[model samples]
Target: MEKTNTVITIGRQFGSAGREIGYKVAKDLGIKLYDKEMLDRAAKESGICQELFETHDEKPTNSFLYSLVMDTYSLGYSSGSYTDMPINHKVFLAQFDAIKKIADEGPCILVGRCADYALEEYDNVLSVFIHADLNARIRRIARIYDLTDAKAKDMINKTDKKRSSYYNYYTNKRWGDAVSYDVSLNSSLLGIDGTAEAIKRLVEIKENNNNKKL
Candidate 1:
């Protein structure tokens, strides 16, 4: 394993195999991978229950009920800044802080949760967006979950929309846009292993070039 502190952030569309690719990349690079485990860390760091993090994971809330119960949720935090924040915002900030701390620790692969935005200022961060054709995603989802094509399509669309809303709400950049990331790859074109190799190649390029211009 190469000794490097580069943090790779993956933004992926639903059923794009982004998490699988990230898993492969992390294994190949001998680094830690954070996905759902981040929720546990954030829950510990923010004093919020793990159930809440799971409930609001990659989900944005814009409801009157959020405002109504905001006070109840705010009492869990000692910080004044988080007092008036909605539950979703508190969750995001907790994850954001956890991401920064994770980056500070060393090399790791973070899938989704706007990790790129959280560590945007760090020179060692490499952000990638993974996407696949709609039909390909639908097929993959259907096969993986044993669902009808139409059901798979619907789930993909809804999940993607939720991720987009969560990302766009928290970050200034648009979600799933190529311009928002250092590099964008289509998993349908190269397959998961191939895409992972592509990202590793990009990492090599960045490492060789003094972490400038991937």
Candidate 2:
């Protein structure tokens, strides 16, 4: 792994081994990996319960109170509008704030919870999306959970839908859209270990002529 200041944010499909890849990337680079740990940090910082963050984790709420959503996802912030908003809005914003705070600290790997969108304004970020074909995902999920193929397929679809909705609802970018990320990988093509290695290469490449002046 190359040593650089880039913060890696991974957006992934269900059963795509995205978290595992993130762990590998973090380990390879000797940086921290933030997944559910990020929720803990957000809960502590915002004085919100960790359970609520867990319950709503990657599931979109029915409400859309834009009035308070922008207060800072405080991707940009003002405190007055943030007060008295719905709990869903608060949870998302808190996580958003947590993402920024984590990135500010240094290079690390952030998995999901719109971390890419949260740190879009920051330099030294490498946003990636990981996905695999439906059959591959179903097989992986089935083997992991000891489920029948049909059951695994159902679970995979539901999880992906939830993740897509949560991401699309919160960020301007569409979930799983290649255009939205700096790199998009098919985990089926390279397998998990190969995918992780690919990501390391991406970091090195991004560190090279990667001047979009980025």
Candidate 3:
């Protein structure tokens, strides 16, 4: 991996306002913000359909199909009577490549898709996990997406479940575990802009040290 000034990867729970925090932090720091834009770029670079990538983005595969999934991934095809592997998984792999490619391009903020774990070993990377209380998350989702409270709650549960599974499967670390991240913030306590400011301060410290060493 090429040297970057700093790379921040945010792992966020649904409706936790983590994306908003990431966007604001990146803006304040004058760095590129990549969320869905990363997906679009991945699709273009890898020649994969964007819709297909979206279908598999941050979704966990059924545990029963673990062998098949790994086999298809490794052998490039299914070995059993099952139908050929879905194109979406292939597109996800492409997006994973694109994620790495994007990180290699320059410093940026990556939201979701286990980006923290993806660049785990890189020295200049900071992994952050943003979370909030259940009621707070539900209210935020309900207001933003115009969902009923119950529906918002359900959506939050399902989305977080998939994210946890996907992150755990790929990284072998507990999802949202505080120890897994450089910093974990409670968005409900500090609010979106406040969270962003805290992240900005951390980034400033990191950049200052990096500049001094150079």
Candidate 4:
């Protein structure tokens, strides 16, 4: 299928092979995939240190910190406001701006960091959530991280919790809720490659529908 001017944003459970599927989809579509690379771009664009983005990447902050950041944003980005804002808020705003900038440039696949919410106003964006059976995720995590099953399960729980908290806090949307995304898929059902192919089909269908409206 020919590529369309669409931005794909993927939200996934820790061990659901979501990132792998995103890579495959981007390769098949001959588009760039933004994940960790987004942090670099955001840091450079926002003039914030790159390490700050990495430190707060997708991690939730306390309510006090949240309030301070929002207040600063509401007051606008004056020198005082920017200086007074917490590092987490600055990192998030930087990433949010970066995501929008990237989408405006062209079609690409963005994994996490609330790209879906960042581009919600864009009609050409597709948001997807990838999940898997807990046992399957445990096995996958264990194999990839070379950890015991028990340790893998712990890692999954912690990572998902942080992701959910961050998403919920940032977007005011429930993370992993089907209602929050255009489509939800179970990676365990079709494997990483199969899932990527399925997403390609969906994107083609969406593009066709979009073309019809034009």
Which residue runs of candidate 4 sit more than 4 Å off their true CA positions?
A: 63-65, 68-80
Best by lDDT: 4
TM-score, every prediction:
0.90, 0.90, 0.85, 0.94
Instruction: Give the RMSD in angstroms, all C-alphas superposed, for model 4.
Output: 1.6
* Tens-digit lDDT string for candidate 2 (50-151): 999999899976544653454435465457656756688789879999999999999999999999999999878999999999899999999999999999
> What are the clashing pairs of model 1?
none
**Residue range 28-126, candidate 3, lDDT tens digits:** 777898998878988899777788777778888775676466665665544452235556556656767877888888789999887887787777888
lDDT, each prediction: 0.90, 0.89, 0.82, 0.93
TM-score of 4: 0.94
Candidates 1 and 2, the one with greater lDDT: 1
**Residue by residue across 1-214, what tens digits does model 4's lDDT show?**
8866889999999999999999999999999999999999999998999888899999998788677658658756787667777778889989999999999999999999999999999999999999999999999999999999999999999999999999998896899999999999999998888899989999999999998999
lDDT of 3: 0.82
Question: Model 2 — TM-score against the truth?
Answer: 0.90
Instruction: Pick the TM-score winner.
Output: 4
RMSD of each: 3.8, 2.9, 4.2, 1.6
Q: Predict model 2's lDDT versus the native.
A: 0.89
Alpha carbon deviation, residue 148, candidate 4 (Å): 0.6
User: Model 3 off-target regions past 4 Å?
Assistant: 1-4, 68-89, 209-214
At residue 157, give the lDDT of candidate 3. 95
